[model samples]
Target: MSYLRFDKTLMINLEESLPREILRTNKSGAYHCTTIVDCNTRKYHGLLVIPVPELDDENHVLLSSLDETVIQHGAEFNLGLHKYQGDNYSPKGHKYIREFDCEKIPITTYRVGGVILTKEKIFVHYENRILIKYTLVDAHSATTLRFRPLLAFRSVRQYTHENPHANREYQEVENGIKTCMYPGYPELFMQLNKKNEFHFEPYWYKGIEYTKEQERGYDSNEDLYVPGYFEVNIKKGESIIFSAGISEASTNDMFEKFEEQAARRTPRDSFFNCLKNSAHQFHNKQGGKHYLLAGYPWFKCRARDMFVSLPGLTLAVDEVEEFESVMETAQEAIENYINNRPLNCKIYEIEDPDVLLWAIWAIQQYANATSAEQCKEKYGDLLKDIIEFIHKGKHDNLFLHDNGLLYSNGENKAITWMNATINDRPVTPRTGYIVEVNSLWYNALRFVAGMMHTGDKAESIFADSLDELAKTTAQSFIDVFLNEHGYLLDYVNGQPSDWAVRPNMIFTVAFEYSPLKPEQKKRILDITTRELLTPKGLRSLSPKSIGYNPNYVGPQILRDCAYHQGTAWPWLMGFYMEAYLRIYKTSGVSFIERQLIGFEEEMRKHCISSIPELFDGNPPFKGRGAVSFAMNVALILHVLKQLNKYY
Candidate 1:
């Protein structure tokens, strides 16, 4: 039995199948996402979602969905299902689905009377094209299939309505018709591999309800334009390919292109294999430069998330060349930050100082994987420049204090990853010498100093000076943040330490260079395990705290209030596992493996073969936030590799 397949029982259950989603992406910033049953439940769901440089830098839904109908013996069987308003389902085609398998490409088998048809889909790598192959498995008579293209040429963030600005015109190109509903957007080309006739009938499909958006308390209804349909006739044992993309050239060699891209993909036979493939999806190219995307369906490549997710997504997977390229891009971004240049921050924003600190940790991982000499040879100047800049206090209010600790006045802003806001106000307002920032500061200094001291080309490149600075910072961290409850304090200023129980304390014990003692590490781990540990991930805040919000529900304001208050974050599991192994040594393998079983099951639950961004901190931790969260996927692969080292 395939772990990623749904049987007839589950496929026919609309309530169950329609909620589970699947996502496919090409590294060129194009994605295909929708329900398991081919029903779009969210506004973000689309068949050909690609970035239009002419518009904003975000993705626009060019081709929303394709409705296919199989006609046999004067009977029309609509194989396209959609949920309308008032819980009404149009065509209700899921009832005919016999099986759904996501092990490879998304393949759905349908049985209409004695006819058996299979639909397989894959998004081309490094291209904005989606190829869908439909095969007539077994049929006694000839069948005709009609496909209607649903076009929503608008930004994914907004809903499109019936408007006069929509151009109901098209041009024929290579046995297909190209059309653009809005001006300045790329024209969408819809074509078939073989010869087919395009029916020129334009109409509006209105009142399509995005249930997921409505549940999140947003406008959910939208209107899509159906330009026309493609008609193709097929016999038994024959197959046809449907191509949708921005460039008409992609329509050529449709079958061969599909086969070529399929061969290039990493194997997806197991949980780790699936995660490995998903990790590659995060490495995207924007404007001729390679960068790691933070998450899919929404997020861009920001500095903090890119650095935080870099090592796991690249180096941990043994992708050295790509890792080097991503590091180069990050180094350039750092240079842009250091010079105080007004970058196109909309593309790759740099706000958090922790991201710069995380670069040291990522470099340390690279050094451990390859060699310290290799790191210095590749990024010696970049590493030295970052350290020098930090020492001189050139960025983000991060300056070395008189007490030998790195201090950032986090006042009136949420600088770190706990940056969730409601009505322009921070939720977890950590506005002092935060615990995690100082921990990262000490670790960054020590890692750089250790590398510089032992590096082959090292001739005392401020080696002793950085070591002394790291020592002072580590001592000050222990003296200031070590709370009476055994775990490190959340933050501190001149007054008493804010002893809030948060998962940020895990980093103090997780990093290679830690300030805590062996007993202190154990106490921190035990406290986190009792209060913050959940099946999905470590909670951002402990439930025992009065500030904890159990439910990550309701509208944007309510959701942001709970986003970091007590919501469980799957990416934090990487640090939690690292801390576990650091304190318990190899004896902790069994405990770590037990906690990972939930995530393995989670791969098949919410987003097939991937992890979501956040889950509810309370019981039955349902996956929330963005569906195919990149950092969560990267950290899962990272932890699995770490576990493999011990087992």
Candidate 2:
């Protein structure tokens, strides 16, 4: 169990950094181009920003990837203010809405892929769903700088969308150069200079070092004054390509100016507070505990996502309501997900699968933390609904799998988040074979038993069943899910799966209700730490495996091939932390303390600001977002709750 520690007075105020210091890798194992970028945003997701390249050459500059689109904005969105570009406002002139701007927009590597053959400084800053790639020519003598705030919202469109580049799903289409340069919406620019507002100093974050310039705040003010961002430059010939969405502009004057304001100003909110604030944002206003699914900050209505994201949001946020609400929201969501049942109707906007053990784990957290009154009053309905869903048996007749596992079968059906495939091919199609599902099932049962009370027959039965399930899981699932040496396999059908060591298996090795023995836990953790762990997070699969993908971007098939094949998933780091804590608490290994302490240290270097979705598997690996993934960071904060040491 974890505890909470809140040091509200501790503030993060980052001052400066050399843009050239940023070196990022793309999904294709290729060096994305670089520019001397000066970008500042307060939040990790970068709601506002001011980005432009300090480039050395003007003629050789080739701009491609840029994010220009209308997101949740203003008065009602921005707390009611006159927008930028109002009669009294000014529009940002240097912004470009792609497709409408120039050349082509391809999903090949990035939106734009070419070289800048200039002798002047170039700075480019923008936002979007796609990965940004820049390839510089050697002829240019320039120190390049790049700025990327792990931005990209989780998407769950009502319908499937055509791939940005390749229309087909399966194969990586390595062909032509189809481009779209149509008229599109400009960036939103909002009015600043408010007497009382959330003011942000660009590029400031928690737990990281930077140059600082600060003025003490007075309680007379509303809250921490968070402002948008401003960039300071010393380079010449620096031109930034500000790009985003393609569409007809809104007639709303407010929207028009907000767009203009957005192009000019960049959001440089505080990642320290943003990390804590974003987590707290998930709960309802009244605070009893109910999830927003995804909030306006990203895509909305993701129940399972919200539940799994609870640890991240609720951890150390200086609020307990989020914890209560999350339990309530998940209770509602589990029923919803099960009601449409298990067919592609998951609590998420994406494919519905049976891997809900991920969400169930959150439910266990709720039971462990919080009060009984809170649970019964707010989440009672949710709990009953979820338990009913489980009792009814969704996929694999899991209620009867008695073998202690849950899974699915068939071609197009889903059983986990790894449902996406190249074209028609399903990335993970394990029809049978017992697995981590049972471990989650057992944990859920034990969790419910505790929440239900001591004398309840159902509670006793659930506890008894938990023991049985753990036994069955250990007897059957262990060997089935693991390879000859005990490293975990991706999954199990009848025959052996490629026997690859994937991060998903880390759940069993890491969680408190782990199905593995003490020895088994040790081996798996070592393997994970050495092979699967990257500077960013845990790789989906071993890099040495045939299925491994060094890069994170490319054709659907290529990306999916790497999805569980090798791309690193930062979200899993929380569980990895959980497992590390479990091992440390037991063996009393001094190394465990280092892991506990090191988790935060690593975060300070990589994920300390906010957790990313996935990272490239290769050297100089960069982060890749499967969805607007920020929950894992929150989860890490949640897991840290158990620490005895001071943060």
lDDT of 1 by residue, 449-552 (tens): 77788654453667778888877887888898887778888888777656679999998889888878889889998999999999899999998887899688
Cα displacement (angstroms), candidate 2, residue 571, comes to 1.9
Q: Which stretches of candidate 1 lie over 4 Å from their true place?
A: 250-252, 342-347, 455-461
Which residue ranges in model 2 land beyond 4 Å of their true spot? 1-274, 280-300, 336-351, 371-385, 395-399, 457-470, 555-557, 586-608, 626-628, 645-647
TM-score of each: 0.98, 0.55
Single out the weakest 10-residue window by summed lDDT for candidate 2: 213-222
Best by lDDT: 1
lDDT of each: 0.85, 0.41
Cα-based lDDT at residue 491, candidate 2: 60
- Compared with the true structure, what per-residue lDDT tens digits does model 2 show for residues 109-210? 111112221211111112211222222222122323222221111111111112232111111111101112111212222211111122233221222111
| Clashes (N, CA, C under 3 Å) per candidate | 0, 89
Worst 10 residues of 1 by lDDT: 342-351
